[model samples]
Target: MQLPDKKFVPVMITPFNLKAKVDLDAVSRLVDFYLAAGVKGFFANCLSSEMYSISEDERLDLTRHIVRYVKGRAPIVATGSFGLTIEDKADFTQRIYDTGIDAVILITGHYANVDDDDDVLMRNFDRMLKLTGDIPLGLYECPAPYKRILSAPVFEKLVATNRFVYHKDTSIELEQVKAKLAIAKNDPNLEFYDAHTPNAMHSLQMGARGMSSISGNFYPEILVWMCNNASNPDKQEEVKWLQAELSAVDPAIHVAYPMSAKYFLRKRGLPVRTISRAHALELTPQQKQTLDEIYDRFTGWCDKLDITPVNVEELMKPLIHLDPPI
Candidate 1:
């Protein structure tokens, strides 16, 4: 597979289903939707998609289906997360790499207290690198409960190995972004992407490179445009204006990220649907209102980009019933 262009805005997909099943139709429609929206690529099984909740067969099934659906229109990256064994990571990655994906995102596997000892972390990283060979892998730097934050020195050492090329920093804190920026700025091959849209501009200005975020999953056009303007001093105000639109939505309403995103996509003239997997977080009345407010703001911001958001009821129908029964 060819290399993914640096300017591409990869939307982290959040698969959803009202019945708590993987909505495969919605997934294909979404792939087409983002491609039309001018997205450079897509990342499946990432946080926005709730990776750990889905089974391995589901992951591979999604990847294979999408690879055939996408047909190389844009690079599709499979997220490397099993939350299990290192061998599991290698085996899964090798299998996915065989599926013709351009790259695989290697996040820290399911382990705890690994961060305390840099040796253990490096051992894992090096082990992955050796197994991957020249498959073109990246790192999803998510410092969550299940995964350890690769320290600066440890990260630098891993990147220096040249096995990994892209770094998606999902660590939400700005200081962490800054710290990663400080380290990533020197590595020329490392393509640093800030998953935190709140600090996207600062990261771009700091010479840290581009972004790939969950928020981008909805507004692929705006996200790609923002990256294009990262180096342009004239577009600073424009980028700031767009980023503000994303901020108006409540960040906590992740229960239905796909629901929220597809709501807007259907509005934008796409055939995509909203679906979620089993074990998804259930939202309350206030949460529903919060999501409503987010789409409200999203529609408002749509005007700024000339995208007229879809009607709420139309999308709400599909959100409530992902697949029209077997």
Candidate 2:
């Protein structure tokens, strides 16, 4: 896919309703929430959005809605993957050219992962990037660490291309994360990000440009504020709050994200759903109940922290009514 020129504060979205529909209003609310809370922008249909389950039409509609809402207030780095063949992925890549978006975050899924020789995939990536028009790209490195971690050498080769651009380094290992950061330090043009929230301080210390994560989706101000003040004398106090917020929910993650997220926000009157219908990963009744209960306390924290609640529609307004970054 094409690469992005600017580095962004990207939040992964969650719009799963009961009918498995893409609620544009909820999406807008999320945009509004982040923009007001000081986020640069978002990556809709990303890992947090459960991209594997949504359809092409849905992705397009969502992007259009987001572009309309953002109205150039912030940059939007969308997703473009889900190809059966090289041409198929390329077709998807070219489709984004018309969407008024800045870049596409390319994930390494939907292709057959053959034994060690990933040359075929890389070649396909080259093709996809060429066909993706002139848009910049954001390489999504959220490889479940155990599943598709690319060698640092392979990563080096990819960034060799001037268009390889920015990267989101989500390899769970600290060394691998540090290796990517080290490489980025040498390449002044490359923008590197970390998604390992638990180790945010260590990451910033090691030279990650910033962080993009689901935790940011829940608490964007905290994440960005912490990064913006990583050098402050009160850094330890800031991290203490981040760690406490991070540990609020179960760390098993994957299946629990949407409900927990919506529950917490809804308790704050954000108007999101309390379930998931896309992936259809059914949570046990007891699990759902536990999520609701944790979110109950989450609401209390939000109240104490003075964080205002806003739904997706109200969040990402297409028009910049207030001061437009003069």
Candidate 3:
């Protein structure tokens, strides 16, 4: 499976039913929606997918299901390990690879108790790689439970091994991003994906490979459009405005977390329920009002990009329900 080009790769959410079970039906619809929207690829079983809340077996099953569902139309990268032990993590990673995903993403702090020590972390990483035997890997600087930002030297060291192919950079610091890009420049295998939407345009300008922001869950095509047009001298002004629009997404939708995202997806007509086991379902009236404004603004921006959102009826027509005998 080839990796997706430098474009919008969404860290996709697992759509659950009202009962909070893994809804394959919803998953099918979402895949179609993403494909229709021109997402370059998918990042599955990440924090947005509630990987921490899900059991190992469930994560494996879901990863396999999505791989099968996509049928290789786009490359797939998945969060492969969250195990406390190196052996366990390697085992899980091997299992995830067996499912035929293109690459595996590892949280930076997974095997370490202390984030300050680089040697310990690198040693643990090397040990895990030894067991997994040359499967491609990506790093996610996910800031949940805790954040372990990779230092420049350690990052260079890891990339030197050539096993690290993709990086989900969440440093949120432009200087650091620049430094990382410099390190990445010499290595063809290394590509950095900026997770910070506010810094996306600048990062792209600085030679980052692509985007892996939460906003892709809602407006992947817009992100794709921005990335494609960001370098055009004539499109500078238009791209600047869209950058602000993209940056505003985190504040509005991230406020409600995975819940707000699910709600927004439902609004876009994907068959997803707002049920998240990782977060509370409660949204205050004021929050709902804020969400409403965000939705309206989002729709306006979509129009500005000349992107039409898919409706539920359109997506569900192929499988329209049959009448139940009562």
Number of the top lDDT candidate: 3
lDDT-based ranking, best first?
3, 1, 2
lDDT of each: 0.65, 0.64, 0.82
Please, what is the TM-score per model? Answer: 0.80, 0.80, 0.93
Which 10 consecutive residues of model 1 have the lowest summed lDDT? 317-326
User: How far is each candidate from the true structure, as Cα RMSD in Å?
Assistant: 5.0, 6.7, 3.6
Best by TM-score: 3
Relative to the true structure, candidate 3 reaches a TM of: 0.93
For candidate 2, write residues 236-276 as lDDT tens digits. Answer: 67556655665555363334666556555554445466556
Residues 52-92, candidate 3, lDDT per residue (tens digit)? Answer: 88899989999999999999999899988667688888989
Please provide the root mean square deviation of candidate 3 (C-alpha atoms, Å). 3.6
Worst 10 residues of 3 by lDDT: 317-326
Residue 272 of model 3: what lDDT? Answer: 74
Model 3: lDDT equals 0.82
Query: Candidate 1: lDDT over CA atoms?
Result: 0.65
Model 3 Cα shift for residue 239 (angstroms): 0.3
